[model samples]
Target: MGQLVRGVWTADADFPRDADGRFDRAASQFRDMHVEPVAGRYHLYVSLACPWAHRTLVARALLGLEHAIDVSIVEPVWQDNGWQFSDRYPDRLHGARYLWELYVRARADFTGRVTVPVLWDRERDTIVNNESAEILRLLHTAFAPLARTPRDLVPEPHRADIDAINARVYEAVNNGVYKCGFAGTQAAYDEAEAALFAALDELDATLAGRTWLVGDALTEADIRLFPTLVRFDAVYNIHFKCSRKRLVDYPNLLSHTVRMYRLPGVADTVDFDHIKRHYYLCHRSLNPRGIIPVTGQGAYLRLA
Candidate 1:
């Protein structure tokens, strides 16, 4: 819940919330125009811990655009400064210490949530886009001509259908868990939980007969949902009190999660350590002591 206020980092700014105490996620800033699909001129900034950011990383790998677009992964922890680069994952573009610093560099008076999965335009010295869903679309299509991947995640006929799937999936399953976890009251939690599981039940049934969500092959819809599903059992199920049903409890979802993880390059992006530590340790509003649980990542791997 930290943000830059006129280029100054604030540890505790007024976290935007509605009157009902529901968490209000800020809209990503850089999403106006398209980034030119040129090789070696753009960079992707992401955190492996964040599902939203993770979505972009998975799409990058799936498209086989490793050489075309460069990526710099921030460390797994969130401190006084929002997402920071570890000594291991230094900021390659500017040698900046914190992610928010890059935001300020782009817009000197930037006053918003400094989020990740930012499509950075190194040539123009600013971000191209920060929204993950848009980034997924751009990654799938904008770079397709130069990409080596065989399949297209978003075909024309399936566009409307995929958008429809994302509408519900984003509300109930993807953002639903956050609504439940961040709910300020029992009523909000209850409502969120009901919707979350209902969506999961419907989706599990929908996926019961097939591997992909919309069509015969993997689409942007699958990329959008996989991050949340992969994190559910490990973090959300326990830490977020999404305990009504573990991801494993649903056979189809568990199968789908296992399959998605086993996909080429998807496994590498699922950083269990980062995912667990970021939620357990960083969200001090929920976890004051910052004690990370000693859960084994193998438990999830064995589910497949």
Candidate 2:
């Protein structure tokens, strides 16, 4: 709803919606900067509540990048100036109050929406990339040499299959939930809801026989879809008007979620407190009184 114009923050409404009231997400701006993997040289800024950001967090953990690259979390509830740093999760890098401050610091003339999972180049004082998909690849490939575990999420033999699944999941599931939630018209909502469930139905059927999305082992496709599924029953199902069926209704999909959650480091990455607070309290339009439902958090006890 708000963005920076040439380094200056403005509260004006500049949503890119078509006449049909369908939301069009803006692309990340810091895409071309090259990030070289150097221990303690880069820091990741993320919000546990954000699905896109969650992808990077999980990748960082799975690849054992915690020792190489540190992370800072923003407050779950977005403020007027956007994602802010509170005393509980302060900006250890610059002591900046808001996430936008880091953007302005990186590029004084930068103009765009300030989103996370930001890969900050501490030595250069610039952003390497803000796109989570790109950041995930960076964590898996560029930083693979530094990983403590000998694993390849995007193995060369299965790269094609993994990419194919990622494309379908990104449109129909990853971003689809958002399309359902932010639809401004009944027709738009209906269209998004139909596409979302169709994809879920297809995915459930696909997973009925296999444990992973692309291959026997975990891949990028699984990492990309897990965030959305993990949040589906909690936020998207109710707050997003995706009421056709809860994620638990799809037995296979729910099984996949628990399997992924039970992974070595994956369980540690989830924060339902941040997840619930951000959605129910932050989106005032969707939740006028800021009342957070108490039903969703218990569903993740399997991870505990």
The most accurate candidate by lDDT is 2
Expressed as tens digits, the lDDT of each residue in 145-228 for candidate 2 is: 788874789999999999999999999889888888888899988998999999999999999989998888999999899999
Measured with C-alpha atoms, the lDDT of residue 21 in candidate 1 is 73
Every candidate's lDDT:
0.86, 0.88
The residue ranges of model 2 lying beyond 4 angstroms of the native Cα positions read 13-15, 300-304
- Model 1, span 1-304: residue lDDT tens: 5888999998773446578877567788889457677889888999999999999889888888888988998988887788998779999888889999888888999998889988889888998899989988888788877687846887888989999999999999888999888888788789889999999999999998898898898998988999999988888888888998888788888788878888898888888888998899877777789887776446766743
Against the true structure, whose TM-score is highest? 2
- TM-score per model over all chains: 0.96, 0.96
Whole-structure CA lDDT of model 2: 0.88
